[model samples]
Target: MIGAVIGDVTGSSYEFDNNTEDYDLDLFREGTTFTDDTVCTIAVADAILHHKSYESALLEWCGRYPGRGYGGRFQMWLTSAVHRPYGSYGNGSAMRVSPVGWAFEDLEITLAEAERTALPTHNHPEGIKGAQVVAEAIYRLWRGEWDKIQELLISSYGVDYERQLPGVGVFDETCQGCVPLSLLILTKSTDFEDSIRSAIHYGGDSDTLAAIVGSMAEAYFGVPDTLAERALSYLPQDMREIYEEFRDRFIPTSSLEV
Candidate 1:
């Protein structure tokens, strides 16, 4: 979870101006902070930990943190009284679905919860699939099944690993574009930080891309202590508390620590 937050914060500054030329980019820049990605991830974790609906938790958290770079449609949904899904297939579904991967041990249950997280807003089939793919990747990595991930992606999702990534600074918010790129980046990366750099190098929705990749990288490589602490610093006390609680309850102490 902290890994996702780290990626969101680190990539926040680069969301608009991607560092296409610098793989050794600074992890954080001036004024970098958490965004809707971190907030929604926390909401997902809170919903699972406290047995609340995804809609209610998202409303409450999003209400608390307005103007954190939420998508226009999501912002409208946030303020409107009507709380039904708007059938979006944006990468937002995958960006916020990281916690679902950590909360459940069973793959079927993980995919089910991932769908539940997406349905409250991103009800499109691609939206739901994006969420499931990220969660399933993280769950598999968490279970130490990383070796089979490439096969799963190719056989099930038909990800063309050999295809070139999108051009730099080309922002694609849809799940179809972002999820496969994130998975490809993960498959090619050498470590947690390298995966994030790869996402940034490819440009386009940097924060969301890094968030999705970071969640899987954390499960696979484990977040560095320095990076984890830096990410927690950006989160407010309440958000930090929820993260701590979720971390304690869901993640094993041996695998990760903040």
Candidate 2:
């Protein structure tokens, strides 16, 4: 979860202003800020902590952070009283699903929770699949099954990492388009920050791409203490508190300290 927030903040500045293949870019700049990615991630963690409905948690967070730059349909759902799903197949589901992977003990339960978390807004099959794939990847990562990660992703989702990435400035919002690229970036990375840099280099929905990659990277490589501390500084006090609580409850004590 902290990994996801770090990616969101680090890539926030690149989401709109620039689109370059510069993997050497700074991790954070003056414009960096937490976006919907971090908010929804914390919301999911809160839901898991309290055993509350994902819909309620998501709505509450979205309402509280109305300026987080959510997608158009989700923004509507956040403001609406009914709060019904709009059948989106966007990457929003995958971007916020890392906590679901960490909260559950078994793979089946993790997959179910991932789907449940997505259904509140991204009810479309692709959206649900995206969340499940990312959550499962995180699960496998936590289990130290790095050898089987790419095989599972390809066999399950047909993500062809061999295909060359699109031009650096390209942008895509669909789950199919972004999730595979994020996973591919993770596969090619040497560390957590490298994974984020690789994802941002592709330049499509930079924050979301890096968030998904960072979530998986954290499970595999663990976050560096200095990097984690710098990332936390960008978050508000309330979000930092939530992140610390979530870390205490879900993450293993030996993994990474908040």
Q: Number of clashing residue pairs in every model? A: 0, 0
Candidate 2: misplaced stretches above 4 Å?
A: 159-167
Tens-digit lDDT track of model 2 for 110-178: 999999999999999989999999999998898898987888668766655445344466777878777
On lDDT, the candidate that comes out on top is 1
lDDT (CA) for every model shown? 0.87, 0.86
lDDT of 1 by residue, 1-258 (tens): 877898899998889986458888887778688999999999999999999999999999999999999999999999997987999999999999988998887999999999999999999998999899889988988889988788767764575644534556789898877887788889899988898888877788898889888988998888888888988899999999999999989887755842
Residue 116 alpha-carbon offset, candidate 1, angstroms: 0.2
Models 1 onward score TM values of 0.95, 0.95
Distance from true location, Cα of 31 in model 1, Å:
2.4
lDDT of prediction 1: 0.87
